[model samples]
Target: MPKTIDDLSTPCLLIEKERLEANCRQMQARARAEGVALRPHTKTHKMLSLAALQKSHGARGITVAKVGEAEVFAAAGFDDICIAYTVVGAEKSARIAALAPGISFCIDSLEGARQASAVFAGLGRTVRVLLEIDAGYGRCGRTWDDPSLVTFARHVADLPGLALGGILTHEGNAYQPHQAATVMAEARDRMLSVAVRLGDAGLATRGRFVISVGSTPSANVFRNAHRDGFSITEIRPGNYVFNDLTQVNLGVCSFKQCALTVLTTVVSQHRGAGGAVRFFLDAGRKVLTSDRAPLSDTYGQLLYHARTMAPHPHARLTNLSEEHGWGAVRGGSTLTVGDRVRIVPNHACVVVNTQDEAYLVDGDEVLNTWRVDARGHVQ
Candidate 1:
């Protein structure tokens, strides 16, 4: 059966099979060259098929952001999994602990470590834990030079049902294209310094890939670090699987490297009294998402035709209603109502979660549809 994007419904996800495979292979090659383990963050697509594709490309393990995602991947036989987010509280801890000793996750404080100790002890399974260090992201973890870091490490080492693995960081501020190298190199040095301090304090870190960092923008930082004699053992780049506008704006990946897109249609069109052209697309904030790339005001980049695969330079997605994407072009569009278009969304990670399944395409020819196995696994 020959399938095409036209046969599929509007406001749905589409992943280019060839581009995705190339993205995975390129990241895998970088990891191999750096001699670091590639544990790609599966939070981007959250599908069994996508994670399996990454694992096939030499991903030693997988990195997920939630306990539910961890459970989903673990049940699918992903033996080595790490919940990149800190799993705290009795409910969260028990759910995550059940996946151990095959699972590992992050922790930032002695309090979370203390909580994990009680929960995992009751579950009777030892879990590996990495202490998170803040590298300018400020969303989680302590600063690298914080005195509580060693205290937290000592507790993780001594706590029952927990083994101190090593240190981790998410240098999210390193997303700047021009400054990523400096920012991430400095972050790597700080993380390594903390690792040295933990060792000097006599804490036995058992995990093999201990000094880890995540962020697609900082992917090459890991490579450079490893090449320059820094001991970073793992990288967890998630959005590299389906690079989005943000990856392109941040200069991490080129525009052509982006694989995921939304197939939409021009449901309605209007011409203002002053002769301005307007278009209302079937996809809205719900599908394309409101996540805009840096300096790019639009929600998603528009393509005139899926078969053409050429980005429309002038047409701008101005606003998004719940079910309508309002766009405008300075000059009149040759497009009319019912014209199909594909959009390269600003954030592939959040956008994929909006769909139950995504059509796999190889240059407009739909090959298959894969379930988003871990979608909505935000627990």
Candidate 2:
């Protein structure tokens, strides 16, 4: 039998069901108002039930960062999927071709496009592909204005077993600024400009130009971007489903809306010189990923007091090692060992990647246990 939320072990990840559904509805309505299809990236939750909630709210499809993730979602009955990463390698190509019958993938290189075409040809299937453009992220995508972009698109179109779906880009660089509104505006403009330029070159035909842009920061600012000129058929935003401390710090979301949290138990408490107090939690880098990006400084944030549901205004996580998180409480609040607390992780995606399953919670009640189906599919 599954354990209830209150009876479950400490230092477990929990998702507030109501908050998650609310966030989904908000994103879905925003995308609908902009007349763009909401194809949320499933890399955030990686749960079949959550993906179904997204689809139920009128999402066009789900987006994934890896072929393995796509396979996971496809097996869960999510047929229409977009592999947002650059398709490469003979092994990966074969896997992609195998999925082509049920899913679509993004291609950023001529070699990858050709390989996909050749592989799909043997199966008598034409794989649908999206040309990934470099929207100043300097990541895996090709330069949007590069003259070779047109040639590559033409090459993919000419391939017998390949269908050019459109262009895609991840405006991940926007997150660097740490300002949600500014990053969002910049992302939308950068992505839309690339789409317009491609359309002007006659590369977009029969309205097949699908301008897809994603990144949690970018999605937050999408409302400001002009919607008419660009053929932005889809908007893929995944992190909105489970807002984390990073999103909260970036101003993308508030603390109340954060649906996912790591519940931990206080293992130790001590008083230091000058009457300062320190508290330690059993949850550490092993459970909460230590992979901090450039702008982030800490592993996670403390959610005030988990027991009383009281907001901790000045509480902060001081340090973290392999298996311990040292917290310093500013105010004179008595904390004892065995006290339970909730931590807002710095990066929810990384936290999810580290766990095999998460608890579905409703105000102290554990409703169900959902597997992190796509966890550890790093390849």
Highest-scoring model, TM-score:
1
Residue-level error in angstroms, candidate 2, position 335: 1.6
For each candidate, the alpha-carbon lDDT, in order, equals 0.84, 0.79
TM-score of 1: 0.95
Clashing pairs for predicted structure model 1, backbone only: none
- Which residue window of length 10 is worst by lDDT in model 1? 221-230
Candidate 1, 1-379: lDDT as tens digits: 4388878888788898999999999999989988778999999989999898898889989999999998998898998998888777877888876674678888987778889889987777788888888977787987898877777677788999888887788888877657777777888788777877776687744345388887888886564443223378888889999999888888787778989988898898988668888989999988887887887888888876777767888888989988999988866787788898888998999889989999999987899999999998887
lDDT of 2 at 290: 75
RMSD of each: 2.0, 2.4
Shift in Å, residue 371, candidate 1 = 0.6
Error of 2 at 282 (Å): 1.1
Candidate closest to the true structure, highest lDDT: 1
Query: For every model in order, what is the number of clashing pairs?
Result: 0, 0
Q: For candidate 2, list the clashing residue pairs, or say none.
A: none
